[model samples]
Target chain A: MSIRDLARHLDISIGTVSRALNGKSDVNPETRERVLAAAKKLGYVPNQSGRSLRQGTTNTIGFMIESTIETADNGGSFFMPVFEGVQSVFRRHHLDLVALLCGTDEDPSAYLNRVVGRRFVDGLIISATTRNDPRITFLLDRKIPFVALGRSATGGAYPWIDLDFEGVAATAVTRLVNFGHNRIAIGVPASDINLGYVFQDGYKHALAANGIPFDPALVLPAHSNEEGGYQVASAMLAQKHMPTAVILVNENMAIGLYRRFYEAGIHPGRDIAVIGFRESTQSRFLSPTLTCFRISLRDLGIKLAEALLSTMPAFRNNYPQERVELIWPMELVPGESDVLKRTA
Target chain B: MSIRDLARHLDISIGTVSRALNGKSDVNPETRERVLAAAKKLGYVPNQSGRSLRQGTTNTIGFMIESTIETADNGGSFFMPVFEGVQSVFRRHHLDLVALLCGTDEDPSAYLNRVVGRRFVDGLIISATTRNDPRITFLLDRKIPFVALGRSATGGAYPWIDLDFEGVAATAVTRLVNFGHNRIAIGVPASDINLGYVFQDGYKHALAANGIPFDPALVLPAHSNEEGGYQVASAMLAQKHMPTAVILVNENMAIGLYRRFYEAGIHPGRDIAVIGFRESTQSRFLSPTLTCFRISLRDLGIKLAEALLSTMPAFRNNYPQERVELIWPMELVPGESDVLKRTA
Candidate 1:
């Protein structure tokens, strides 16, 4: 049923019905109830375009990700919790999220041409930003509001919420060293993705701080997946001189490493030590609980929502201080997989 | 940089710069080159709002979830692949996704009201449909295009895609019975959610098909989670007459059950045969592996997207054969966790 039908049934002007439904104070209480009852009975719902045209804001935020790369890379499972966290805050704030999936193959200009040119969204939350990303430049040039999930390596230039990868890696490395493991290896992705770089840098710095010169041979770069981890670990184990301990960049890789070690007749926590990143729900129940870096994927989502809600203009336009860097610290969860001395 | 600046720099009209950037006709070939070169040099991008205002369609779809209940329950991890699948199609179609997280506490009517009333989206995809859902009625009443991920129990009244829970459960139970297991138990959620009912129905039908009378004593209904599985399994084992095989409704619960079995000095494959639904990426790698149903969360996402995209106003207005059920079949992976030999 249309608003006109509700108005006719309530014996009121269409304007009166519209005002009452819009929650405007001009409508009388009794008349408003009458209109509402009629509308509910007839299943009349309002249209957003008309409201948006009148109100000038949709009260909705848009979340954009590079779709092709995301699926190909299989990042959805890892990134799901972050989306949940973002949704939590958006629900609390009565804000709606509009998720947009774009491709890197598309003229980077297409994202702006669609999101900004069309004015489809009030703000944007972008994930998996790369160095010299044209999307960042487009958003900045247009003065559109947006927030990045990862920081650019060049400097603290963009408004982002990131995990302290360096800190987490250092802690894991230190724990391994304290357990009397000197020959240590670090496994990470070979891609130019920002997270990969952050993890690799952290692993390098941690080794340096421990008075151990970085060994190029010990640094293994794979595809950031289980099979990649398995292949890398297996090859490393087959080498004449093998590292006693390894620091894996993510949980999937770590799980793969564990399986490979088991197949090679090497038991984790006994013959070799393993430390990894990102604590998952299933980690605790594994045959040997994984010792890793724990970051709240949900909490990251909340921060991203807050960043988008702040409506901060893109980095180049906003003042340096206005460009916030909200970095969440990572904590190390020591599990049976790591052979560390008991403090107690 | 604005298109006007790039136009002046390239000695071209603002229209040529815009068309060139949009990859549209009505522009000379070399002039398009000059405009593109200048735009690239100047980092000029077109405005999306102005373009969308003229074009009418946003080339975007909306995905809404009951964020409050979903986050509180599963933390939204289960829906990631579904989103990824939708995203895969969106990328190919050059369409974007706008995600919204609605709450259950709020009037369910508000969800359809905001989407339909605002005309903020072209189509919608929703997950976790409840019985007697007002949102469904509103969408139906408004003739708004939408698709649900899970089917409603009231038969095919709406377009939806769901796993063949009954088929999978029946197969699992039959497998257990054929393995010479007379005392078998089914563990599922005690919640009022639609999945709980679907799972229970499957379990009951499976037993009935096997000529075994359904036993309430062996049906354990707890929360659908790891902790719930652990608790339920422990309680079942404590009974004077314990079931030989247990079929869990979900993978997380099975993990917990495995833990409990390990603690009780009973190996999963050796002492207590176990079968459950598999959802995690690492499930196959579990010790002795796991005998469970595998459904592609990503494929489900894609199906939901297809259903939403196919929605038409006629279907919305006349309640046109809106019910579309796509049942994803299950495949059994032989694992050491269920090593019982077939008796029949």
Candidate 2:
């Protein structure tokens, strides 16, 4: 059954029924309650297409996820939990969440344009934002409401919630420096994503803050997997002056780094101190559990979704303005992975 | 810019424009060429929402993903690669793929009904099908074209592409049996999903085929993760008739199993042979490597999508019926995880 049918059955005009159903102040409260009771009793599920056409809103949000071979641990293990948090908040607002994925074969911008161009969603939650994201420009040009799950160098008034990469880097480096480690290596994504840039800047800032000389030779760009970790370890070992400790941007790569260390007969907690960015379930169980930062992915997702809604006209009243734009920080979880002191 | 605007600009009927765009036989080749050229020159992007309303199809497919705390490695590492395969095929047919995640607060069947009722997609690709999936009956009753990524016992003549769980189990069991082990323990999902049932059936069949008595005590149900693997390992060690060998269903859990073994000062390959089901990048890099089966996830996804298309009336001509139903097998990759003879 539709609103027109309900209106006809109640011997009322369609406009009156629409206003009553939408809870507008123009309608009588008793009449509105009566219309709602009749609609519910008739089992009339509102048709999204019909309503969205008239309202210019779908009551839905799009979360665009791009999958590359490197970060494709299903968009990095952080997505689902974050999605869970975002979904919870969306549900409170009677909004639906849909994820738009770019096929490996398709152009990312074109793929995004196809959905946004068609007004497939009212707003968007764009995850894993790169340094110069084209989607940001595309969305801005269209004036679509959106929030980025990660930081981007693309300057604009768009809402974004990124991990505190600088904090993580400084903490890892300072902690290492306290242990008297001058030669410290770092593993970051080879791509020029904003996180890598921030992570490097943090590393440099921490070294300078701690009176350690900056060395470009210590930076290792690798994929966010075990192979990248292994590659970084091998590369570090080959250096004329090997690093006594290493900081990994992504903890998933720690598995490979640990394996390579094991293969080289070097113990992490004793011989070479190892630190990782985020501690995951996998990272938690590693031999001498990876000492890393713990960011509540679900909370981040919740904040990300809230950030998007804050930009949208629909749900601005429920969320605060300042809370929408945030640099989400992660707390350090101490483990045995980076507890070593470099003794001469 | 839409088809109607393009037609108005060209002073032609909308049907002629549409037919030309879709490469229909009714349109003249030169007229079709002219329409395509003009459409491209004008940069007309078809409005999916508008077209869906008129055609009674959205030209979009929903891939439903459920995330629970236990199996939530974002539905494990298997989904994204398979989605890539599915998206690749869907792209060929000019279909958009969207991910539908069930929030922890929502009921699966109710959540599915909401999406389907709203006419959000033309068809669906439901992942992680349970033993008696309600979606099967729901889709069949609604007459919506859909496919399951894995098999279900819902019992209907619909398309499905499931892994060869029986083959993997039998191979693993027979291999372990050949290595002189009568007491073999197996870890399956605690959930009542079809894969778990089939995996257990295959284990039983393999045991019976090998002339070994089936002992109910040998079956261990655990969460499909590292902690689950650790739990299974701990339970195995405490048994009065401790298993000589153990087979893990999920390979991601290998990390936990290895850690537990190391903590217990028990050697996996020598003390108690351990075999994992799938060989993933994570499983491949374990200390001694995990002996598991390898299946091309991309190929599986391609088959799953193709199978769904065969059931879809719009794309029936592009795909054959025989390719719809499959019991895809995995190739055994030798690793040191399970390579020991029990000294009886």
Candidate 3:
């Protein structure tokens, strides 16, 4: 059955029948019901694009992720858990998730345009933010509903979920200091991402609070992986002024440092002290388990989903800058890696 | 607008309008044009459910995954990569992905029913297979197209992609033997998964191939995580007849073994040699650097997607005995963790 038959049978204009079926308020309620019932009976359905253009919703969320193999590998531990958490909430709400892997060389904006301009999803979840990120500005200018996974360094007006890096770093330092480690080194990612800066600030703050002068030479920044840790430790071991303890920002790198120290004929717990972030299942079983902070990526995902859902407008309008920052508390798991006797 | 409105505007019979929109052979050319013109002007669209029912296809793939924090963590590493790889292929083919996370407490069959009976997906990719898995039977009996990520022990016929655990294990053993380490212990997962068995077979085969008798006492099966590794290694250390070297199957467990060995006052490369499978970026920069095999999860994902697209008919058939198996080759990276001098 076609709309023409329903219109002829109802003795109304075809345009009137069309307007009623499309849920336009201009159509009379009684005529709209009759048209809907007739269309339902005839099994006539509208197309997604047409429905989206009319109703302004796709009931889908687009996630634009950097598809680089290297970043993806780190994200396995860093970003994926958060995604799983977000998915859990979406599943409960019966919402669909559309994932787009943006290549490092390709402008992510192009992909976002394809999804947003084409009316594919109602909201977005973005990760791996940089200072003055073009993607953030594009999403903001377009009035697209989105929540960032991390805070932007340039200070954007966006809702985000982040860890208290500075707080955690300071805690780690103080714990090591209380254990009588005067010469402490801070290891962080070499690149300038927001977390690196936060960690550095925390390290400095903790040193000042403890009356220990910050040594610029003791602050080592390397790539955020085991190789980075191994290289940093190798360089430190070669230096004349070696630290009694080390605070690494990355978890995988700390694992590398543990191995590096072992290779250099040094016992992690007995000789030198170490602390890092991210508590992997492997951290607990290391001969002298690693003392580190644990954060739930899944919780981060749930928060991002809630933020996205709450921020979406019924129609395009300027959204309020309600920067909802969900900061998860870091818990330290003490292990054999930091067994230095208290000197203070 | 409804289809009936388009038909009425064109002054054509509802049946003729329906036939033309659905691409039926009997519609006259002039009448088809009239119907097409009216549909274009009015924006009439057919319903998706009716079309799918008529065509016997939804053009979507279902991926059922176990929903545990540990499993989810592994999913980021093992599943997401493959999912992305498959997505790359599916995007070209104009297919969609429907992901389902199944809980351990909930019946897998019920979840399968909601997705399959509701006609949400055309095929499935089931991960973390076990012996006599009910999911395998449900998909097979329903004639649903699916490929298992891991091999099933029940001898159920199905296409699958798996890591060559036996081959890699044997390779690890021989490598250790070549380095003059005769007494080697093999670490397996304490879980009842089929991969653990495959690893055991490989470890024994390699030892036998090198003219060394297999020692059941040397076979250590623990949980497939870091703590499991620590407990198993601690046990091995306490043993009167300790192996000069150890080969671990899982990467998480290997990290634990590294720590346990150190705590036992043993140097990884000098006092005891170690080898592990599944090399991550973190493993490369370990103190002694870890010697192990690496499997690409991304490659596995791409293959699964190709399989899903090809086996649609067999999947829809009552009997799903046809099977495809793809084995990924593992490469060995030399590191100080293995005592190379022992074999010489």
Candidate 4:
């Protein structure tokens, strides 16, 4: 069956039927549903490959996320809101968004090459960017329209919208210092992901600004999850001079830290001061509620979509000169986790 | 750049090069990396569409998931492990898995139709099955190779592998009854998802089996997320008689329930017994650790992949007579939350 037959069967105008099938906003909801039902019933399989080749577009955008153990443990909470925001923007333009999940064992660059070569999506939004990401270089070499969700030190000058990890670290350190914390420790990600580097740099600079001597021993590296937090607390307990305060790069880690502390009869707000990376439903409800940063993930997703669309030749006009290289800001939410005052 | 040229340039046999490109296990990891790197550097764009059409297969699998707020809140933690398991199986067969995320506002059936029509994937794995799912009917009508991650009341025999919600409800109720609790309650999904119906039915049957009258007021329907759990707690508090024990279908809700109970100066294990549906990283770390069920999601994913493959013509022989209609089991892990005995 074809579009013509489908429209005739539904007793709707061809334009209305086409518009409904294309997911155009102008069509009435009832009319769209009716058209879709008729099209499906009549087996109207659109010549997707032929049409895509002819029109030079598939009208689909792919958001690539890696489903690593670390990501599965926490990234879902981060990506879902962002996806909703991105979808909100794409819907108006009759675009469909699909998540291209990279398996833990697969090489991301090779996966990108295969997907890009297939020409399945008009553009891509790649997350979990590492230092000098090869995917960025590959995308640039192929002249593919794309946006990186995290900043990379790669050679290409492409659009990226990263969470202000440096700012978060700096702000957190400043707060701890003002609270009379001279001996402070930070839990950094052990992975080569660029955020860890940025966070460490920010922490170092903030310590320097406070006129405090940098102690390499205070910087603990661990997996960016609850286990990591537990490890950080363990390391602090083992320290010759325990830090008066500790800052964690991953909020999920707070749970583990709290558990470890509780086992040793230590209370977060009463015995030690703690600060987490971001606020989440889980973090908000933690006993002695976690002090963390908050960002509108949905708004960030909208910006990400706009930034990607601006790079694509077809939709560049809609977002004129809107080439974004943003460091999305996070606001601190004070809670009971960091209320301790240091005793001299 | 063709495979022939690539083989010659790398001084590798053409068969080895082909095997490496196809992701065969026989090829050395270093050789595969060399082949992939050379292929990318030489700009060898595989004729994916042409090859797919000629072979009548795409060597790709699509797992359809909805990114609705309800799903976004808790589904991420659940799906990530499942995805890892699914990928583990698919990688062996050189099949790539992509998640087709249906937007919150979009109709699931319509999205399925579009993706199926595009011939993007050779097979599919659909999740979040409703009481009367249209996607199942559509897939069945098209004679597409697919598997449902949950069961539906829709007609036509199809493969499905769903969590044993009924068994869980019954088992929890029996345990609570044995603990001398007559006024037990259950929090179920407000949506018309099939699991809710199964859970409620199991609950009612269990209540009858325990010689206790089934009160409709005792059955609470919520959004299947943390906020929903809070609402359930509030509703129970407002009741004329509060339940001594309660069961939640979604483990994520336990967090909200714990928050609400803590605010009301109620201790879970001492005041009211609680049993959550599944064990998770967050739940395991909850204060007064949650009593819940455990299922290896990775193992479930592997089974799901095998079940779907059994339905496909090409892979049918590999898993003969494995047309799965499984009610996957969950083992109970007793914890501190449900140790209280009801007052005489």
Pick the lDDT winner: 4
True contacts kept of 4: 0.46
The superposed Cα distance between candidate 3 and the true structure at residue A151, in angstroms, equals 1.4
Q: Report the error of model 1 at residue A111, Å.
A: 3.8
Measured against the true chain A, the candidates' chain A TM-scores are 0.86, 0.86, 0.80, 0.89
What TM-score applies to chain A of candidate 3?
A: 0.80
* CA displacement after TM-score superposition, residue A34 of candidate 2 (Å): 14
Clashes of each: 24, 0, 21, 0
lDDT tens digits by residue: candidate 1, B1-344? 55677777777787777888888887788878877777766655454334444554556677776654333335344655566688766676666776665654455457657665555566778766665466776676666677876666543356877778788788888999899887888887775557767877888888888888888888898766667778778977887999999988777677678878787877788888888776455466565567887777777777676666656542233233445668777677667677854344
Highest-scoring model, DockQ: 2
Alpha-carbon runs more than 4 Å astray in model 2 = A1-46, A74-76, A341-344, B1-44, B74-76, B341-344
Give the CAPRI class of candidate 3: incorrect
Model 3 alpha-carbon miss at residue A199, Å: 2.6
| Interface RMSD, prediction 4 | 1.9
The docking category that best describes candidate 4 is acceptable
Off by over 4 Å in 4: A1-43, A341-344, B1-43, B341-344
Say what the interface RMSD of candidate 1 is: 4.5
TM-score preference between candidates 1 and 2, better one: 2
Interface RMSD of each: 4.5, 2.3, 7.6, 1.9
